[model samples]
Target: MDPDGDPARRVRGHGLGLVVAPVLRDYVVVDIETVPLVGTGPEQDIREIGACRVEVAPDGRHLVAERPFHRLVRSEMVSSVWGSGLSSPSAAAVDVADPDAGLITCQAALEGLAEFCAGRPVVAHNGRLHDFVVLDAACRRHGVPALHDDRLDSLDLAHIAAPRIGIELRPNADGSMPPASRSLDDLAAWFDVADPRRERHRAVPDAELTVLLIERMLKTIAGSEPVRQLQRQILQTGRNPWARFLEPPPADGSLLDCLEADTARMADSSGLSSDPTSRIGRRAVHEAGIHARAAVRLDEASVLAPLSPGGALVTGEGRAFRAQQREMAAAVLVALADGSQRESRSSTSSAGRLAVEAPTGTGKTLAYLVPAVACAQARRRPVVVATHSKVLQDQLLTDIETYRKSIGDIRCVLLKGIANYVSVGYLDAAIEAGPEGPIEALALAIMAGWATQTATGDWDDLSISQIEAAFPPVRELRTRLSVDELREFATDQADRLCFYRCALDGISTADIVVANHAVLVTLDRVVEEASHVIIDEGHNLEDGATSALTETAGSVALTALLDCVAHAVSGAGVLRRYAAACGASPPHERVDEAHDALVQCRRALTELGSHVVDYVRGRTEVTVAEAASFGVSYRLRPGLDTGRAEFARARRAARALADHLRRLSGCLALEPPMSALGTRHWRHIESELGGAAFWSAAERAGRGVAPRPRRCLQAAVCVPRASVVEPSEAGVGRYRDIGRGCR
Candidate 1:
């Protein structure tokens, strides 16, 4: 029987209508093979076109109907485009049809392909980068109208559906190099989708494989309730749920109104709660009461006694507590609760600070937490638990939950910087602007569901890097909202409002506030409010402090600043617009002077940064060694001095640039003509000047050869010493010398 005549091989036709539907309809999966041209022109040719129409059941199972549409188009451009007569291995891989066998012209093939697609949404693997570009170029070259249907990329879908199977590198036959693992064949194998064609790299087999991959991907997404609800909302509204946030708010009311209405409609139809607080509010309140009662019961003896070894207070669940842990907890509790302990000999009362040193697996987290929570409860002040790493923060959170059950319900909140939370207003603005690509649309969809379900709007909870990677514009959209704007937007939704209140405004009110050291150190108010603070992984404190305090005028940063100034001088950046709005055009001569100064500063900084890198590399030889207990150690070569002249020159150039910035800002801040916005810009420029000064000061302090006002720690060195060791039954081993002779 002829393959085209067989019922199983026949293509099923579906009509395309722009109507809202709860289920997807009239979808096509397409793939094309093409010969790439060396130069830009209509000099490339499409070798073949293959497509499969997909049908979805009401229950979410999808079927791929193999009505294969295959076409071979003749083109004279191939020989000229390939220059070397198509002798490349990749070119030789393609199976081209015979020119004498009545193959259709390029125009005819595209027209036939368009007819087959019927204006339906098309799906293709890596379509954004490869397939779509080829098809559009081929259409343009042949004078055929371009396919205008909505396009989706299976490559992006694969990332969302099977995130664990990231692109891997596989060695070639000669083991010379490894290629990126994004091929259709590799992806098919990864997803366990079957490709029946005997030869790979052909259009038809790849198209078929893509359809099977889509089937598996959709099945996985459909299995997830959050994703499925979002999918349905997108289909039913005929507007991408995530993209809708980018839309402009209604003129009469706030953006929050629009978000609430959309969320309420979705919740009503899908039976999901728009309010996350309803799920956890009552328990949170009850827990607060439990913590309050528990706090009142804690005195010095009660707090310290339970932690002591073999004490009567160690009965029940506390029996397994270690002696070291009990001692650490007692020290922390005494420092936190006793005001007398805070009194120093200098006649001034300073807050008592305690540092506990314990090795790994010694229950440091619980030891600190038990005392911190009890002290916070007794003192009626928040206890800040700051960690050095996210791993420790997550582990502490897990332990906190365990403690909540074992101890009492203690109210806690995880607070991060403003950048970590998504702003609904900014998202609305982006939605109004409209997403530019399929990946962006997908990211918006995922975020839409998260916006409703997430109580904190924290990016960490969702843990979807693919979404963020695909749509980086989300980061640009994370603008800082003013207090009034935040309150107005959060007024209608209790749970949404709670996030801002607990995480930002009322942070001091929470029984326990968990954060990273970066947040506590940067935000002084947080540190000031905490009656008790526990710095977990305190061994990393010095390094963390250095990183936070140090400022360097690097080449990349200088280049970016120079570019911004260039744009402003050319009347293209925010500064130019602000000046124009203020009805005072900056003097052209002043702008030119500022621009010239910045260019010189950038050159000096670049030279200085490169010299610093080379100097450090030449002086320091870092060697990794295994420690006796666990982890690794870094040994740095010592007694190397930095060039004083080089440091002085860089510092002088930085100071000159900062002075220029200050002068320019003063010109812009002229009182009579400058508006509030213009003044804000002036202030911003002043802030930049301040930053430059700070960087210069840090550089001087770090590398200064002469006596200075402040003394800075320049380097950390690990010294090794020779020791005589007696061989035991186990073996001979090296030991650290702790005596005066080693020093």
Candidate 2:
């Protein structure tokens, strides 16, 4: 029999595609115990099957487990736990019951378990990840009904319900995270329930324990029916809500046409404008050479066609082509084209700004975006559209996709500062360090799950009120480390930056880069490539600019960076690892120099924070109560001498630490390595010490002129690498990932 033709094999193919599964009132709880089918492979033969049929009472007030099934199965093959370790019990533990309860055949056991399921949904503690996975593999080897039901995991429900109901997971005894070691044991301990069998986990007892825990969690959240959040997650087990980004490109044989997704894309690309009402308008643009892809010249009539009544946007796209929208778009189009020509003609020319004070319903966002996208495509340079607020940036991004789909493939991206992304390496560091408290634990667990599933690698979506109600650690996760950093870190380690989908370095060729004004204020080197700039909501620009331009060495930021530096130099840190990779440890005195400088920097930061606190206390005009009610504002006035000495001290200390770090990096980089992966690591450090994440003031050439720091965070650190990881393998020219994530 062809395995591909197997029905069970087909089911497992789409297992990860679960958007939802029906949640029935009654279900079967299954727990299976198995050992490797051989001395070496992943194939496992089930040694025991244990299950209980759970039923919700007619009134839906309680859960009941009535029919129970247990079997010690006979196997033709001798088995051991092998390298699987504690995940499976040894054969000795399996036979602890009387040495001869007389085992059943593999076929008999599977048939009996399927009968026990009796056509009900199956629930288990981490069933989808473990139990059924082994079962499916076993069934494939043996050729039998796999008994795969609508699989549900209690572990997912616990993660969701823990915070809402005030529950904390019992951190694992080995100090590792649960869910790898995720077990019925943790849930049983939390709910004060335990597996009933005397020796524990003889199968049926474990199933009973899971059923009880699920009941407790479900009932605790609400009445007999599970709370909607819990129910949604349980049904959609693998479909993490955070895993999604922009609407998925249409699927195969989609309803609209043959190979509809491709057809739609072709239609979108084939014309300068898809507006059916503007056929005559497009003909005129084509004659003006404006409808041609790169030959698209920015002209008023062609640019406004897609935004006016005759455009495709008025039909399937929800936008009604308003005359004012067209008028504004036309005005902006002419100004941008004229300015672009002027700038190309002379360096000092004023690429002027045009502002429109139009009514609220005039479709102002589309007005600017239309001209911007058209001009960018025409001029063959990225156009940057800066929104005054994050909300408007998001809204404008949506508007571009919605209304402007007819205008064409505007290869646009929402380019944000690196802080808006979470780094996978740092996330692993946080989990390995363990959360400081339960709220932190819950947030970490949710983040870990989101990292696996997210396409955008966007930061935590927690609302402001939600973040404030939680602890400070949630904010820490949000600010430090990003996916852009991992591309470099992983490159040196030769590890796949696989877990994150934040397409690292994807924005370089994007036709339009939508950014917030704060990003614009940084004068981001990437945004500097823009041929045209569109500033939306100019009314609020001054406030956003002033707030962004203000410099502050935040207590939170300073401490987080300090922690990363400390971790890199610790005894088990990257220094030791890098030294070993290079065939020798640094001289003890040299290593000591690095540690001593780090210590001084920490002391200086603490002193600086203390000085600023004291200075703000007496200098601010507003009272503390009023400040707390609104927000804290303190201006650092020069010559007023508030904390100036402390600031100078801290900067010097930081610079000293940086200097020592560079000397060590240069020492190690000069030493070559034995293996391909190690060679890659050494060359990365060897090349970038001039000014990587933790830098030395060693200079590097930018052109034959302007110098730029060759940035790198230590191979171990994740926070500041900001897409500036420089990898130089000999004869392969230096390339840097400016870390612009594109969707």
Candidate 1 global lDDT: 0.48
Candidate 2 whole-model C-alpha lDDT, 0 to 1:
0.48
Distance from true location, Cα of 46 in model 1, Å: 21
| Candidate 2 lDDT by residue in tens digits, 1-743 | 22223322111101134232222456778888776665444466788889888766534333555558888886545433454344444454555554676687787888888887878777777665568777777777768788765676666446544422111211121122233123567556656665454357568777777777777765543322212222222222333322110111122111112112222332355443332111111121222234345547555656667776778665564557688777777677766675444333222224456667898998888787777877777776778888897777667756765554466565555555555655545554434333343344445545544432233344523222243332444554454334332334545211333223222233444566677787776645556688777888878887777655542223344345444333433333333433444444343344455556556555654454443444444444444455445544444444444236644543354344445434434433333445413333343333322223433212110111111112332321212111211111221112111211110
Whole-model Cα lDDT of every candidate shown, in order: 0.48, 0.48
Cα TM-score per model: 0.48, 0.44
List pairs with backbone clashes in candidate 2.
179-182, 275-312, 692-711, 692-712, 693-712
Query: Distance (Å) between predicted and true CA of 142, model 1?
Result: 24
> In candidate 1, which residue ranges exceed 4 Å CA deviation?
1-52, 55-63, 66-151, 154-255, 258-295, 299-354, 405-408, 417-451, 459-464, 467-501, 550-553, 558-743
- Estimate, for each residue in 1-743, the C-alpha lDDT of model 1 and write its tens digit: 22223322211111112322222444788887776564543345677788888775545455777577887655534454336665344433333543356567778888988898898788888776668877887787778998875777776555444323222211111111221244577656756664565468777777877777777765655442443444333322334422211211112122344345544444345443322122222223322433334346456555555456554334576356577777677667666666543322221223667766788666777777777887777777888888886556656777776666455556666666444555554443333323334444455545554444444555554445434554544332222111111333444343353334446544555667777765665567678888877787777876655544433322333344444334323323323423443445443344455556555555554444434333333333322122223422222222223234434443354345445444444332322224433233333333222222222333332221111101111110111111211111221122121111110
